[model samples]
Target: MKRTIRLAASIAGLAGTIVLAGPPTTIINFDTYPDGSAVQPTDAFTTQYSTVGVEFNGPGPSGNSCSISPPNHAYAKRIVASFVDPCTGVASVTSYAGTAQDSCWVPGEGIDMFAYDRDGNQIGHEFNAGGGHFTAFSFPQPVIARLDMYCILQGIDNLAFIAPVPVLRGDLNCDGAVTSSDVGPFVLALIDPSGYAGAFPSCDIRHADMNCDRRVDGLDIQGYIDAIFPP
Candidate 1:
């Protein structure tokens, strides 16, 4: 239930001044995805980025490990990789320099890492040096897009991503702004949450419940309109 407030013209004029902020920026932790696989090799990643083709030429039965979640696409400011190297029980990370392999690796020694941008250009490279290694790199700018990664490591686990802050509530289209464009989706969600979710999988449905009543109804719709129109 919601309480109704009636005010004189002077006070009502300020009603439209009420503004609701967008959703809080949050991190997109890849750990949400299960382990033992490489982020399902998304087409979005494959189409946008070149799989740098990590190669391991060590004598000690070398291999690589990588895992990411949401299985198909990633919308994050940056991706984080965590790993443990069996050979040294440590991790090594470095910037990639267009070399066939990470220069960090010597003749039959250590691990090499290579990171690439969407244009198949080497952007960064790093290797783990020791226990519970973690490193992150940001995109050219803050964006919601997919970035593919490959690693020739011993163990990979708990991969996560970082989502920027403050989601714009009512911007169901996620176009960075709220307008009439959101009305259709908002109505659809108010009537059918599942259907709406299916249509906009990336949208946080909670943001639609503008009244904070935990329910989507006519009142919420009116509240959304008020937030948009404002006194």
Candidate 2:
């Protein structure tokens, strides 16, 4: 659960705090909507920040210091590192720009969050795991009522933590992966007929997708056979 705390942060002497860039909102605290799917609206957690308070507190950008203090009134999905404009409700963002500090994911990391208009045109994106937070993107010049969010996190152990929690959040078959192959075809059929390939509990072979194609097909079967062969 994304439980929020509001405790005063206990910082030891000489703790460095430097300005950084980022996003600062956490959402879907206790639901199964990693892609914000079926993400219901809850009370808004607002912070009055500005370009004046943009700062970072970690070894470097992309640092895993996601935390908040007085952890009661609200909670941050990860520690606040920085902000885009720091004043406006964020619309665009990035994380861990090139610097001396080496990236944990080699050439660097980009846990991307994509926002799109209803027409499926990308309006904005945030690198570095939504800038270690989330952005509020609106479609059609910020007037459209709906803007969809989808994300990809690399080297995020938090993803591992959330995986077993169940819910639609565990849908690894997203990205049409569940529909990338025969299994996807099956899901399409399930969506259409509801009693076809998925009629049997044992037939939900979505995971049978071995090529990351998100399907159960001849390729997957061949992959399985490949695994059994001598290297």
Backbone clash tally (model 1): 28
For residue 37, give model 2's deviation from the true position in Å.
Answer: 18
Best by TM-score: 1
lDDT of prediction 1: 0.40
Distance from true position, residue 135, model 2, in Å?
5.5
Q: Write the residue-wise lDDT of candidate 1 on 107-163 in tens digits.
A: 332223445543456555555333334444444443322223343432332223332
lDDT of 1 at 186: 87
Candidate 2 lDDT over 1-231, as tens digits, reads 223222223232213232122323232222223334331234332222212222222211132333211111122233332332222222223321211111223234344444333255655555543233323332223222122222133322221100011112112233322223344444443354345344444333343444544444555555444433424
How many clashes in each candidate? 28, 16
* Model 2 error, position 71 (Å): 16
